[model samples]
Target: MKSQPSLDTSPKVSDEIRKTTCYMCACRCGINVHMKEGQVAYIEGNRDHPVNQGVLCAKGSAGIMQVNAPSRLRAPLKRVGPRGSGQFKEISWDEALDMAVGLLRPVREENPEKLAFFTGRDQSQSFTSFWAQNFGTPNYAAHGGFCSVNMAAAGIYTMGGAFWEFGQPDWDHTKLFMLFGVAEDHDSNPIKMGIGKIKARGAKVIGVNPIRSGYNAVADDWIGITPGTDGLFILALVHELLKAGKIDLDYLAQYTNAPVLVDAETGLLLRDGDGKQLVVDRVTGALTAFDQKGVRPDLRGTHSDGALTHRSVFQHMIERYLDPEYAPEAVSEKTGISAGKIRAIAAELARVAFEEAFELDQPWTDFRGERHEKMVGRPVSFHSMRGISAHSNGFQTCRALHILQILLGTVEVPGGFRFKPPYPKPSEIHPKPHCKVTPGAPLDGPHLGFVHGPEDLALKDDGSPARIDKAFTWENPMSAHGLMHMVISNAHAGDPYKIDTLFMYMANMSWNSSMNTSGVIDMLTDTDDSGNYVIPNIIYSDAYSSEMVAYADLVLPDTTYLERHDCISLLDRPICEADAAADAIRWPVIEPDRDVRGFQSVLCDLGARLNLPGFVNEDGSQKYDDYADYIVNHIRKPGIGPLAGFRGNGNKAGRGDVNPDQLDRYIQNGGFFVEHIPAGANYYKPWNMDYQNWAVGMGLYDSPQPYLFQLYVEPMRKFQRAAEGHGDRQPPNHLRARIKLTLDPLPIWYPPFEDSHV
Candidate 1:
C-alpha cells in the first residue's frame, strides 16, 4: 500500500473517439463520444466547437442513455387493434415502406392535401418541407406553432432576426443585460456561459418573468410581472423612455422605419411610383425614397396632399406611446409592476445605453453610402423567448419587446444583442405561404412562410382553408409557422377539410404536445359510424414508443441521434455564433443495433418509391441512397446544398459544386464548420454594407440585402386594411372586427382572450 499500488492517475477513457453534434437539446453542441470496445464509453463537449466551447450540459453528457434507452422502438410496427390500444405487429422495413407508399401514393396522385405531414422540433426541416412540397401537400409544417412561432414570426417581421436560435446578447461587451421570460432550458449552454462571462465582468443582469426561478433567480434584479402583461409592461417602458427623450433618435432615423412617412388616414406607409417607401428629407425638406443616398430622414417630418396627411412613423409613435394611456401609472395595475419600478428600470436602461456607452475602433460602410469613423456602442442588451410568446397577445408582446430594444438602439450594435448570419434578411425576401397544390405534381412553392397580406392567405378559390391546419386563414392570418397544433383536431372535426392520412414525425400529439391530451387521444382513436377512424389513415415516425405511436396505423421506427445522419443546414436552423456563420453535421458514430432507420433516410426511400421529382433521377432510379447522400449531392441552387462547408475540392465555405468528401471533411473538422465574419462586419449588420457583401458571398443572401428595422410593420397593416373594407380579399364579417383590432401595424397591448371569456 506504499503509493496506492502506484495507481495510473491519467487513465485512458477509451480506445477511440468520435466527434458529432449532439441532439439531446436544440443547442446542437459539438461533442466527442468516447468508444471503448466499439461501444460508447463517455461523452464530452468538443473544446474546438464554436458553440459551448467544451462545456457539455447534463443532457448532452447523458446522450449515451438516449442512444441505448430500453424504450427505443426496435422495428416498424403495424396496428393490429384499435387505435391507442398499444397493440401492434412488428413489420420489416420493406413491408413498412410498401404500406406507407400504398397509403401516400394515392393521396399524392389524387389530392395531396389529403396527406397532412408535420414534424416536431426536427433539425431536418428544410429536407422535410422540400419532400412535402414535392408530394404536393400544402398541409405541412414543423412544431413551431406548438413552440415559439409567436417569437419567431414577430422577430422576423420586426428586426429581420429573432432571439433564441437566431441571435444572442453580446456577453463580452454588454454592461447591462436584460432578459424577459427566458427559461433555463432555452439555449442552455451558450446563455449559461454568457451569464457567467457578464457576471465575471461585474455587469448587471435584469430578469423579467412571472416566475422568479431559472435565470431570474441569478439575476441582479428580478421583475415579477403579471402573466400575459409583458406587452403592457414593455410599452410602459417605451412610454417613459419616449417621454424623457431617452430614445436613440439618431439611430431611429438612420436604421428604422421610424423616419418613414405613413398615411395618417389609411394607416399605410407612403410610397413613391416604384413602390419604394418615401421618407421626408430633413436637409432638403423634400420627400424621397428612404434608401436614397445623402437623404437625412426627418423623424418629425410631415406631408399633406389635398384630402390626406402623412406623418413620420416616429411622430405616430410619439403620439401613441407618449399619451397618458401608455403611462407607467396607467399600465401599472395591469402589469403588476409598480410605476416607480418601471420608471427606475427605464432610467437605468437609458443610463447604461447612453452614459456608459463605448465605441470600437473599427470603421465600416453602411448601405446608404455612409461611412462611420468608429463603431458606436450602447452597452445595454435585451432578450426574450417562448415565455412571452405563448399567449393570445404573444405576437404583439414580442413586437413590443423588440420595439423597446430598437428604442434603446441596442440591436445589432456593440455591447448589445447581435444577429447571427443568415438573419437580418427582411420579410420582403422570405417566401410567402403557398397552398397551390396540383394532382400528382409538386406544390407551387413552400408550404409555410411569412404572409404579407390578405392576398397571401392560404385560401382556396371558393374561400375555404387551403391547408388542413387552417393556417394563413383570416382567423390566423400571420401563422408564419403554420398551425401544427390544429392539424389533428381540425382534420378530425373536418372543420376546414378532411384528410386521408395524418402523417407526422417526432411530434407526440396524443400527449404532452396537445393542449387537451385526452381530447386529442379521443380524436386519434374515435371511429365514425362506418367503423373507420375519424382521421382515417395514420402514419408516424419516431425513435421511441411515445404516446402517439399507439395511435398510428403504421409506425415507422427511427434511429437514435448517434445512429443517424443529420444536417444543421444553412437553409434550416443553423448553429451559428455572433462572430461566425456556422453549420454542423451528425453522422452515425455507432451503427444502430436494431432494424430502425433514420426518419429522413426513410423519407428518401419513400420519395423515390413515390417518384417524387427531386428524389428520383432522369431514368426514374433513386437519385440518392440515403440522407447522407442527399446532404452531399443535392443542389438547392446552382452552387448551394444542405451543408455549406467543404464544397468543391474541400475549399469552399458556402457555395460550390458537390464535394463527395464533404461529410468526411466535416468529421475531420470536429463535425462542424464555421466561417468567421470579418471584424469590420461583426456588428451593425442590418445596415452595414461590409456585412451585407459578406453574407452575399456566403450565399446567406443572393445579393446584399440591407434593410431597416421595421418598427412600423407594414404587413400587419395590410391585413388590417383588408378587414377595414379596403382590399378585395376581405376577411369574413364575423372576423373583420377582430382582425382590425389585433393586426395593428404598431405594437399594442391587449388583454388575454381568456379574460374576455371569464
Candidate 2:
C-alpha cells in the first residue's frame, strides 16, 4: 500500500535558504528562512546557534506570517481626522520626514527637555538612546520600566548582574533547580531546553509559583505560594537557613560584603579616608581594607572607636534574619505555605548545596591573590521573573531573592547561576542618571543609569522632578530604567512639566502597554479650555497599524523584522552565553514590497535632517547612510563599535578598527559571532582574576573590575540618611517617612500597599 501511494516526496521545499536572527520576540534566536522563487516559503532554527541550539518557538516559526501579514503599514501616514478616530492619509517618506523635523527642530533648538522620546520593546536602545542624548532630551527610556526594570535594577544593585538575558542557571551539573514566578512568555525557548536537559539528568525541580502551568507543570515539587508575598516567604527561608547554620560561611566572607564593618549608630559602612570599605582581619587582629591580600576577614569581628561602635555586616544579618518576625511559623499565614514546607525546602536546598557539593580540578586565582586548587561547586540554582518584581515591594523582594542565592554559595559557580559577558559589572561603574539638559546641545551624559545617592537624583534647583516621567526623583530614587509608562499621562497632566512633542517608537501606549487604556486614549485626545491638545504633537513609528497609531499626528511606517539590518550588540542587549561572549546581526533576507523604511534607518535620516551633533560630520554632512552603514562604520569608542566580532581587518574579537566587510563575514558565519571563555575563567567570574583579565581583554571592561557581591547595599542607606535629614538633597515631607521605612540597607519584607486598601 505504501509503495502504491508513494508520491514526489523528494520534491524541493525551497529554492534557497537564508540565515538570520529572529526578531519576533526578544529571544533573538537564529532562523533559516527557506525561499522559493525569491519569496519566503518556510522557516526553521539554526542548529549551530548558541541561544537555542536548533530550538525555535512558535513565535519564531510564525515570523513568516509577520513579514507577509496584510495588516502591515504600506507607507507613512498623516492624521486627517480627530485623535483616536482611526483616520489617516497615506504620504511619501519625504513628506513624513519634513513634518517630523518641523515639529522636533524647534524643541531641540529652544528647550530640548520639552521633547519626551521613549521606546517600547526596542532592540536597538544603544543607538536610539544615543540619538535622544544628542537631541538633548533627558526624558528618554525604553519599555523596561514597565516591563522588568525592578528585576534588572534589583539584580544590578545587589549582585552586579541579573537573571534572564544577563545570566542563567548552569543546567549541565545542577542537582536542584527552583523556579519562582517566571512568566512562561519570557526567554521561552532556552529555558524550556534547559529544563528538558535537567529532567533528562534526573535532577529535582521545585516550582514556587501561584500558578501550576507551563514549566511548573513538569516540576518534581510545586509550592503554590500567595502572590505579592514572595519577599516574606524568601525571608522565612533565610531565617531557617541562618538558624540551622546551613549557609556557605567561607564563600560569604571571601566573596561578599559579609565581613565589612558597619557603624552601628549611623547604620553606614565604615570606610577609610580614601573611601575603601574597612573590614577586620581575624588572622592579624587588625582593621584593614577588604581587598588586602592574605587577609582572612572575621565575620564576627567588631571595634569601638569611643564615639561609635562598628559591627560586621554578617552580625547585622544574623540579628536581622534570626528575629522571630521572619521565622517560618511567623510568615506561614502570610505566605500561604506551611511552616513545615518552608523548613523542608530550606533543608533540601542546604542538602543539595553542601552534602552533594562537588569540585572540578581546575586551578584559578582570586582578586586577593589567593589560589584555589579546584573549582568547588554547589549544585543548587534558582530563577524568578515579573511575578516577584512587578509590585510595589518588588525591588526589595528581588533583593531578597539574590541574598538567598548568595547564602547558598551558588551564584557564579560551576553548577549554579552564571553571568554572560559584559556583566558582573558593579553599580559603581555604571553611569548616574543625567538631567542637565542644555538647549541646542547634547545631554550632559546618559539619560538612564544607576543613582547612588540623593545627590544623584534628577531634580531642578527647586527640588521638582527634572524629567517628564519623574524618574530619579525623591518618589523613586533608584529608577535605573526611566518610567516610560508615565510619559503620556505626565505630559498630558503637566505634572512635572509639559512636553511639546511626545515622540514614541514601537510602543502601543493606548493599548496593552499602558495601565489605564481608556484614560490614555482620553489623554491623547484631551484638550484644554483653548481647545488645543494638552500634549501638543505626537509622532509614532511602528511596522504594523497597532491601536496607538490612531492617536499619532505623524506615523512613520517601519519594515518587517526580516527586511531590516539590526545588531544584537555587546554594547546593548547581547545574545551572549554563560561560557562564551557572543553577538548577532539581522540583515534583510528579502526586500519589503511596501514603501516603508526600518525605524532605525528612518531615525538616522531624521537625526541628520535635524543636524544632531552625533549624526552629522564636522562639515555638516550625514555621517551614516542608513542603519546598515551605522552598524559597520560607527565607532562608539576608539576601537569599540556595536558588534564585537570580526572587527579590525576582520580578525579581532573585541577591540579593533572598523572592518568594511564585517557584514559579509557575519553572513558567512551564520549571522553571529562567539568567543568561548577559557576553562580557568569560566566559573566564579566575579572575583576570579582569570575571568577579570579575560573580560578586560574582550573590551567588556577597561581594566579588571573584580568586585564583591554586595550582600550589604550601602546606596540604599544613603537615601535613608537623606530621609533622616542628613543630606543637603532631602526627600519631601510626604516621601521622607516612606523612604525611611522602605529603603533599609539590608533586605526587608513588607506587605504591598494594596494590602492596606484591602
Candidate 3:
C-alpha cells in the first residue's frame, strides 16, 4: 500500500451553543452544546446552567452516542415491505408531512375522539394540549398508563395533586434520618445533595430496604422489611405511637378532620340537635357516633352548617378496629414479620421522637440533618414508589399507607409528609390575570378528581372548553372496565366520539402499558377507509421503533438530548411561605443536537397551520415561534418566570446561571412563580372545607346525609363486610377480598411482579 499523506488526527473545536432542556427524565435539566465542524467532538456539562450544575450522569454522558446512533433515521422513510418489518424508502419531509396531513385531515372531520395519541416522556416543550384539542380528541393518553398513573391516583385520594420531590426534609434539624427506598448515593445528583447534606450534618441514618444498598453503608441501622410490607410496618409504628402517647396533640387537633361521623340514611355528615357536627372521640380518636351503650345509632346528626357528615362511619371503624385491641400483633401476623421485631422498631422510633421533641425543642436531625430518625422517633413520614405498589391489590396497600400517615400525624409538616403543590402556570387569557389568584382556597374535597387542579379544564386549540363534561369527568360511567369500553364502542358504532387522526409524541406503548400489547397494536392498525383508525391518520414523534410505531403512517424525526434547546423549569424551590425564604437554583450542563427540533416547535407549527387559538403574542397577535424560542421566551418572558430568575443571582434578565441577584431581577421583571399568584385583598374565596362542604358550596345540594367524599367507595372492605353480614353468596369479583387488613377485613398478599427479586 502507498504511504498515506500526513493528516491531522486531533478533533477540531467549533463555536455552537444551542440551549435546550433534557426530556430524557423528569429532572428537566438544561444544557448548552458545543459542536465542531458539524460533528460531535466532545461533551461538557454546562456549568453556567442552573439545574444540573456542572454534573452529568451516565445517561447524560452518552448524549453524543444517542444523537449519532446508527439506528437513528436521518430522513423520513416509507414502509415498502411490510408494517413493523423495518423495510423502508427514505422520503423528504415535504412528502411525509403532506401524506400525513392528507390521511389525517379527513378522518379528523369524521370522528375525532376514537383517535388515541399515546405519548411517553411528554416532557416536550410543546403546547401538547393545543394539538389534542385542535384534533378534538378526548383520548390523548400518555405513558402514564404504565408508569405514574397509579402514583398520581394515590396523590389524588390524599393531596389532590401529583407528588413531586419538592418538599425538602429538614435534614439540618433532624437527628435521625430514616431513608426509605431512596438509597442516597444511588439516586440522581439533586437528590444525592439532600441525602449528602443530611449525612454531613451528623444525623443518624437508618436505611430501610429489602436488600442492602449503597446507602446502607451510611446507616446506623438497616430495617430489612419484606418488599411491599413497608406500609404495614409504618402503620404498626403509628399504633405504637398512640399507645406511648408521643403525638403532637395540638397539631393533630388543629389540622386533622379526624373527628366526624355521618348519618346512614342521609349520606351526609351527621350533626347534633344544636346543629353542631358530631366530633370524633378524642379518647379513641374515632368518630363519636356510638351511643353510651356502645350501640351504633342508625341516624347520625347533621353538622353545624347542616351539611352531611361521615364522622360516625370512620369513628365506628377505628373503635371497632385499629385501636390497641387490634394491635401490632395482628399486623405482624398479616405482614409475615414477628411481633417482637415490630415492637422493637416502634420503640426505637418512639425514643427518637421523644428526644427530638421534648429535649431539643426542635425537630431531631440525622448526622447531616434529616429528622427521618428511626431511633426513638415520633412519626416520620414514609413514602413508597411503584416498587412498593403496582400489584393486584395495589389500591388496598396504598389505602393502608395513607391511613398510617394520617394516624402518625405526618401529613403537612416539615420532616413529615405534606400535601405540596405541582405548580401550574397562570392563564394568560383571563382579564384580571388568572395567575394572580390567591395562594389557596382551603377546599374540602377535590375540585377535579385525579388530575392536577390547574389542568382541570381541558383546553381546545383556542384554549377554550372542549367537551366540558366529558373532559373533566375522571369517572366515566364505564371507566371501571378500563379502555375496553372504548374498544368495544369503536368495534361497533366506531367510538362514540369518533376519532379520525392520531398523533403520538415520544411514546412506545408496546412494552409499557399493562393491557395486552397485541390488542393495542391491532387497534392502532384498525383504521378507517381514509387510512384512519377508528382514527384516520397516525403520526408519531419518537426516537425508536416499538409496537406503537408499527401503526404510524408518518414518523416525525425527534431530536436527541444533545440536539435540542434546554430549559430549566422544574428545579426545587420554596414550597410554602415559610420555606420561601430559602433560595436554590439548578441549571443545565449540556445542549441537544442541532438536527432535531423540540416538540414545542412542532406544536407551534401545527397551531399556526390550524389557526386554532390561545398561544398568541402579547400584542394580541399570533406570530408563534419555534419550540426553542417558545421555551427561551417563556423562561425569560415577563410575569411568566417566577419571583426568582433562572439564575439564583437575582438578575431577572440573566439567561445563564441562576443566583440571588438574578432572582431579584426576575421578580422585578414580572417573572413567573411556582406558587399561585395571589389575587387582590378579599380574593381568598373558600371553596370547600371538605366533600360535604364542597357539595353545598358548589351548589350540588342534597338533603343533609352521611356523605362519602369519594363519589363511589369500592374498597374490598365494603364488599367483604357485606358478605360476612349476608349469606355465603360470594361477593362480586371486583369486590372479592384480596389484601387482608386488621383495620378492615380479609388479609391477602400477592408476590411482587418482578421477574427477578433482585
- Across residues 572-594, which tens digit of lDDT does each residue of candidate 2 receive? 89999999999999999999999
lDDT of 1 by residue, 1-758 (tens): 46556779999999999999999989999999999999999999999999989999999999999878999999999999888889999999999999999999999999999999999988899999999999999999987888888999999999998897789998889999999988885589999999999999999999999989989999999999999999999999999999889989999999999999998887889999998888999999999998999999999999999978889999989989988998989999999999999999999999999999998999999999988989989989988888999999999999999999999999999999999888877888999999998999999999888988888999999989999889999998888999888888899899898899989998997543466988988888888999888899999999999989988999999999999899999999999989999999999999999999999999999999999999999999999899999999999998999999999999998889899999999999999999999989999999999999998888999998888899999999999888889978878999989988899999999998977776
Cα distance off (Å), candidate 3, residue 665: 10
lDDT of 3 by residue, 1-758 (tens): 99989988874565665444344456544444456666665455546443455566656655667666766556565566444556666677667657765665554555444445445655431245335544554454444434433444443343332234423344334555565544432125544555577668665667667777766565778777676666566566666766676555443332233334545533343556755345554454444432222322222222333553344343443344356544678777655667887777667655655555522232222111123222122325444545444443444455555554444444444444433222111111111101111111111211122322223333333433332123222122111102321332243245224445556676665554345676665665565577644544557776555555566667777656555433333322222221221222222223443334455566666545444334455454544576544443443232333223344333332223334344333323222232222211001011112322222221222211221122112233333343344433233344333311321321223334352435
Model 2 stretches astray by more than 4 angstroms: 1-5, 510-513
Q: Please rank every candidate by lDDT, starting with the best.
A: 1, 2, 3
Each candidate structure's TM-score, on Cα atoms with residue i matched to residue i, is: 0.99, 0.99, 0.64
Q: 751 in model 1: Cα distance from truth in Å?
A: 0.8
Output the better candidate (2/3) by TM-score: 2
Global Cα RMSD, each model = 1.2, 1.3, 11.3
